[model samples]
Target: MLQGWGIWALGGVQRIGRAHIFLAHVLLGLPGLLLRLRLLVREMYVVGVLSMLLIAISGLFVGMVLALQGHNVLSEFDAEQSLGVLVAASLVRELGPVVTALLFSGRAGSALTAEIGLMKATEQLSGMEMMAVDPIKRVVAPRFFAGLLSMPLLAALFSMVGVLGGYFVGVGLLGVDEGAFWAQMQAKIDFEEDIINGIIKSLVFGLIVTWIAVFEGYDAVPTAEGVSRATTRSVVYSAFAVLGSDFVLTALMLRGE
Candidate 1:
């Protein structure tokens, strides 16, 4: 049993090493993505623009829920007026990056994997390769960069909308002091420590999610069933990667502070 466990651990490490190598190749090809600016823009429109509505709605609702729940708890402690600080800190520090990443993994990341998988199934990628065109440069790289570029902005918007939602529920509905809420939030939330680190977290999550999406699609077996399976794996893997990385990043960032 101990030997079996050792072998399993070794296999996992080998897989991680191979994944790192794959990521290096993909990243090294990123300069070519700039040459395919038109493709990148199109991907941005599809992955970023189309995803905004869902992100906005989710952000707003999440904030409202947090405010509602936070109020109930804080009321018992006679600290309901601190609702803004609670909402802002929670959204900006943790929820914004993590939730936005999960949503992006489901929405844009899955879509990316599906589209690429379908292209592979249809032999589009192969045809490009046979024609002496590098599909990774022309196809995958643009989508990868588009996801990376969109993520921080999406997370920022989500945080902003969440703050508004919190205000609407806490101040407008619950009649907490609006001035105190905003003031406490401003006093507690630091620009560099909280906001910037959150953006960094989003950026990292975006890279991990999109990397899994594009790589899974690219490596999928060239069959309809394979495409379907790849798409599912992309979402599942991206979610796990995002959550796992979040814990590590949070620990490192907090230790730095």
Candidate 2:
């Protein structure tokens, strides 16, 4: 049992080292990414545009639920007027980036791992190597850059749509005072503090999710089962990383306050 534990520990450390080296390679390829602008745009469409519908729908329902629950809770204190502030703050600061990243990981991140893993299984990467074409630069970098670019934009959209959904439920359905809703939200929410912090969180989550996805794919054993396992690992690992990092980041941000 002790030997097994030691082997597992060593394997984990080695995997982490390989991931860091993979990240370095991806970063080193960034300069050449601009020359392959078309590839980046295509990946942006694949990961970003395709994922928007899921993000928007999830945001809408999440906002509605938040407003409903918040209304019920605040009404106990006779403070239903603060519903807008509650919804906006919750979505902007916490839910927006975190939920969107989780969804992105399940959706686009898995796709990335499977796609790249299959490429490796099919010997495409090996073919590129034989042709003196760097597959990391030609393939992985664009997808990585796309995830970084798409995540914050998607998070912003989720927050905006969620706020609107809250308005729809709070003001239209629950008879919340529209003036109080928008007014309190405007008054209480700080752009730099809430919004900027959310953006930063989304960017960090983007980096984590994309990095894990690409590395898993690149490291996958060249077989169908390996690709499937890699895809599963990408989602599972991304979730753990996002949630753990979120706690750390929230603590740091609160301290800064």
Candidate 3:
């Protein structure tokens, strides 16, 4: 049992080391990305634009549900008018970034892992080496930067659409005072405290998800089964990382408050 534990621990350490090295190689390619703006734009389209519908639809339903539930609870306290603040604050401060990251992981992140893993499996990545081209720069870095840049924007869009959905439910359907709802939300939501912190969280989550996805692909065994496993690991690992980091980030952000 002890020997088995030792082996597991050593394997974990080695994986971590490889991830760090992979991250370094990916970062080294970032400066050159500016010169190849087309690559970045193409990836942004794949990772961001393609994912918007999912984010927007999810945000809408989530906000509608929150409005319905919050109205029930707040009504007991005679605070139904505060429904807007509740939905806005909940979505903007927490759900916006967290949920967006989770969705991105399942959608774009998994796709990235599968795509890269297949490249490796088919020896396409190896082919780049034959031409003296850096696969990390030519392939991995654009997607990495695209995911990073797209995350915050997607989070913001989620929050915005969510707020609109909440408005539809709270004001149009539930008959919470329209003016009061918007007023309370505006009065309570701070630009720097709520919005900026949420953006930061999304950025961190983006970095984590994209890093794991690319690394898993790059390190995958060059076989069909290996690529499949790597894609699955990408989603699972990204989800865990996003949740864990969210708790730490939330604690730190709320410490002052």
The local distance difference test score of model 3 is 0.96
lDDT by residue (1-257, candidate 1, tens digit) is 99999999998788678767767777877778777688889999999999999999999999999999999999999998899999999999999999999999899999999999889889999999999988887788888899999999999999999999999999999999989999999998999999999999999999999999988888778898998898999999998999999999999999999
Give TM-scores for every candidate, taking all chains together and pairing residue i with residue i: 0.94, 0.99, 0.98
- Collision count of model 1: 0
* lDDT by residue (tens digit), candidate 3, 114-228: 9999999999999999999999999999999999999999999999999999999999999999999999999999999999999999999999999999999999999999999
lDDT: the better of candidates 1 and 2: 2
Residue 156 Cα positional deviation in candidate 1, in Å, after optimal superposition: 0.8
Scored by lDDT, model 1 comes in at 0.92
Ranking of all predicted structures according to TM-score, beginning with the best and ending with the worst? 2, 3, 1
The residue-by-residue lDDT of candidate 2 on 1-257, one tens digit each, is 99999999999999999999999999888889988798999999999999999999999999999999999999999998999999999999999999999999999999999999999999999999999999999899999999999999999999999999999999999999999999999999998889999999999999999999999999999999999999999999999999999999999998999
